[model samples]
Target: MGLLRLGAAGVVLGLASMPTFGQRASAVQLPTYSYFTVGTSVSVPDRGGAWLDGVDRAGSGVQSFGSARLLGGTRAFGTGRSAAGVGITATIHDFEALEAGLVDRRVRSTNAAPAGNDAWTARLDEARVSRAGRGVPSVAAINAELGLAEQAADQEAAGWLQRGRQAEEAGKPNVAKIYYGMAARRATGSQRREILARIAGLQPSPEAGQDAKTSETRR
Candidate 1:
């Protein structure tokens, strides 16, 4: 699946905590509530192509980023097993190719700039979801009950860079400088270099006179 998605809350407590294979003393396997998982397999065709493939049991959430080679449209098949304990499972997918397309409506509406009013927000939301939903599994069940969503670690870093751009465009050099510094840490090599260049341009250089004075003082 491409960038498998996650849905809301699900518990994945360890089976060890429960009665073992031999002890027949009355013990219950804690009822696990399932959440929605978004996945992509080659099997989904046409409209279903936008859907994901996977089963999420109660109280369990999934979050991962990874790539899946489509076997055939609407015919690909794969398997995943639930762990015996309480935790989330994730698989990494290549997000670079998909970045231009996916956008969570909820995220955009909740966090986009004001200039991108509700109308603009809706447009951007649609664009992102359309891209992200591709090959994503259905997590409605998980989200409706639990409330988990698949998230990316680098997502926050991208946000910071965006904010920095906004600050820079608004003529807030000091604020932009701080943001650029942050972006340099989170960004890739090329992006980091660009951010550093921007920051260097905005900063004032030390005066030669001050340098000489400092040297004399030290002597």
Candidate 2:
């Protein structure tokens, strides 16, 4: 994967990388942001470009967006891809140094239960893990702290969208789907619709495909 300089705004704990594949990612150095920016693996053509994984591939973009909440500030997920310019997104969860850089450095100013807007600042410590998190237990908090009840869902969705797109580019559609699924959960309004559509565009399971064919035959 090329460097993941590209970023979209979101509300979540401090941005940092997460380790994918139970290990740290290569040191390609994705850009740092005060908000969480998920990490992705940077890969090169394996020796002599012979490795199947090294080949660069392109993926489809989101033509639709979420329709949840219906908040005004919510921007279309990738409605204006041309304006945003194509950039890499975090694909795999295997980010390097995440365990050491972020999870290990957590600190809490107080013993509060971590509610309200303050939760949005939980701390990704995000190398996707560098945020020295605010001492909230479990990854589920990343959800509430990301301000789930509020309108920041689109912001959070964008980050996930980028990851799915980048994963697709890396010729990893299954991985992309994982991130896209995550985005789908958080996305609202047009963003959600588009992401769902994008997921549909990907290949379906054999059971689902057979069902579709059966339904078509019945029709």
* Index of the highest-TM-score prediction: 2
lDDT of 2 by residue, 1-219 (tens): 233333332222113212111232232323422222222233221111111111122333332222323331122222111111112333344243356366555643233244546544654323234435456467887676756565666877899999989987876666677778878877887899999898888763344333223311110
lDDT of each model, Cα atoms only? 0.47, 0.49
Could you tell me how far off, in angstroms, the CA of residue 68 lies in candidate 2 after the best superposition? Answer: 89
Top model by lDDT, which number? 2
Off by over 4 Å in 1: 1-154, 203-219
Q: What is candidate 1's lDDT per residue for 1-219, written digit by digit as tens?
A: 333322211122223323333233332344444444332222111112222233333233333222223211122233344632122233334354357345565567655544645787777766765756466556887575443222342455567678878976776655666666665656665666787788788743233223223311110
- What is the lDDT for 54 in model 2? 19
Clashes of 2: 44
